[model samples]
Target: MSTQINTIPASEAVRSAEERIASYDWQEFATELSGYGCAVLPKILTPEECKEIAALYPHEEHFRSHIHMARHGFGKGEYRYFKYPLPDLIGGLRTALYPHLADVANEWNARMGIDQRYPAEHKDFLKQCHDAGQTRPTPLLLQYVPGDFNCLHQDLYGDLAFPLQIAFLLSEPGEDFTGGEFVLTEQRPRMQSRAEVVPLRQGDAVAFAVHNRPVQGTKGNYRVNLRHGVSRVRSGQRHTVGIIFHDAK
Candidate 1:
């Protein structure tokens, strides 16, 4: 018997995403990420694509697992991890984004005095994660109803973790939801934590540090830990797609 190969159809969403990424001002993005520990990319997804992803939240077949944040003390909402052979739209974003972020990750690792440089291709990095026995998918879609929220936390799944991750807002801030803003907090050495609210409109995405980032200090570059979450939603509903490059155990 001959084995048949199944190919995914081309997605306009993915094509558009590639074009957007290709046009990004990496120099500016790098400067922003270095200064603030995060960077924003607007309109990575179309409004229609956002709506489509949000609609997929209710379909269990598309996901490998569902997690209730409140059950784990993570927060009050829920999220579902995409199964292997992730939808083309999601997979394309991951593939298109990896190389650029890998460069930044390598740079940050060097500056922070850390070892382990990422590969130029995302597949090579995934092989590393799988070799370490982390075989589960980590990209997920999060849904929040009114009064729902996520607590500040890191997305580290296993020892092998990518330095950065991205989250795209699927719902309009005021029209589809309210008060559920993306939040990032940094813990500086010998100082109180500083919090930043990242204002995101529908289709806008934020690329942020997964754990710690290098910050220049009087002595030298120091590592500042980062945690991200969502504020409580006061009304309507909120949805988002989180793209994590590393797999889970």
Candidate 2:
């Protein structure tokens, strides 16, 4: 069902966010996660910006139209993840949606631990990733986990990829729900299953490369990737935004 979208003055949110992000130095994060890969950008979006995004949910709903494969690992009735696209508004979309994410991506790129894997791999093309046959060039997806969850697996979308991903937690998380801990894989090769569970609060975000770390080859040394999944929210609903960037792909 289509719902109404209420657009607020989110440009101000972006502007304020830009200032904070500029003054904020992630040098510690850079030092700590050199090889591991992690950065926590707090309050990137004001409460208002987040609320506005949530408001556009049903109005911008696309998954309702198509069922992309999700991890219903528990069973049939069990929904693992509800991933959908986000709309791009001008004063709304560009300033409101992209800046903070772009900031994270750029910051992570400079770090040694979290390699800007894709761009390094695709130097042959004019851009980091090539958009060959795909219809929509840069696709953004949001996951609605109203008890749904994502089982651990590397997001391998052919070669058109974003090396790392960031989650924009739009809800109160635990307060709004429970059991949605995001587990991350620490070691690889010998043992591919050990993962550390990290619980993120509302407005908080987590970032990491698809594979665990940077590979030496132009292709992939594959960081074993995180074998992640949600613990199961027995109570409330969960809404998360995941934005992936590929060179034009």
Candidate 3:
């Protein structure tokens, strides 16, 4: 069973998000970032932007899966995040988007008085990671394998920073697949679950922190940290375009 969202296009969503971000004031946006270390900007990218990215890659019939899990659940998450294959796409994205994303990241850093702001250097770091990759959630991508899933985990990649990442949901998620839901949960001593079965549409995106308490589970614990993962796609395939920001080493 797979649920499809006949929503807007990717390019349109990206354009819209770009427009919104362009006008967004860092001072005000910081409130949400401080609360949950993330915020959801709707219509982030239009369907067309999604297509433009897909068009760049010629070898896209390779939709596969990878099964990953954790202590929380059985069906954690599935891969096949983006149309571009690994390594190449990873380097391309780092080179292409890093420079452009720098201006915005710097603004956010300056406004927040963050100690780290190294978009240009980070681009080079990612380029070097084309072959050697790690699980710290850098500017790398993972392919999806049937019956495979991702488990809840924290994205601890660098020393410290704000707005650590901005991921693009290339696939429209829904209940059509058995699992494959974007389950985001807060981790506090209380262990409450503030999870949303958010299967963001292909043109939409949700950004979060590398470490923050999940809204529900953060009562008793001190900085329990936000954890998210995929639930597993029993039926169809899932795709995504993920980009992570980091401080230079």
- For residues 89-125, write the lDDT of model 1, one tens digit per residue: 8888998899889999999999999988999999999
Model 2: clashing residue pairs? 34-113, 80-149, 89-93, 152-228
Stretches of model 3 off by over 4 angstroms after superposition:
1-20, 23-29, 52-137, 142-146, 158-163, 174-179, 190-196, 213-222, 247-249
Models ranked on TM-score:
1, 2, 3
lDDT of 3 by residue, 1-249 (tens): 111112455444444444445654555544564465565555555675555444433333432323244343644442333323333333333444444445545555554455556546553545444434432334423434367677677655444443456666655555323456566676555557566556476766566665543232323224445677776566755666666654222
Q: What is the TM-score of each candidate against the true structure?
A: 0.95, 0.64, 0.54
Per-residue lDDT value at 48 in model 1: 74
- Give the alpha carbon lDDT tens digit for every residue of 65-158 in model 2: 3233343343111312222223432123323334434444445445435544332221232243444532233333344444556656666555
Q: Which candidate is the best by TM-score?
A: 1
Highest lDDT: which candidate? 1
Q: What are the runs in model 1 whose C-alpha is more than 4 Å off? A: 1-15
lDDT of 2: 0.48
Clashes of each: 0, 4, 47
Deviating ranges (above 4 Å) for candidate 2? 1-17, 60-131, 134-147, 214-224, 247-249
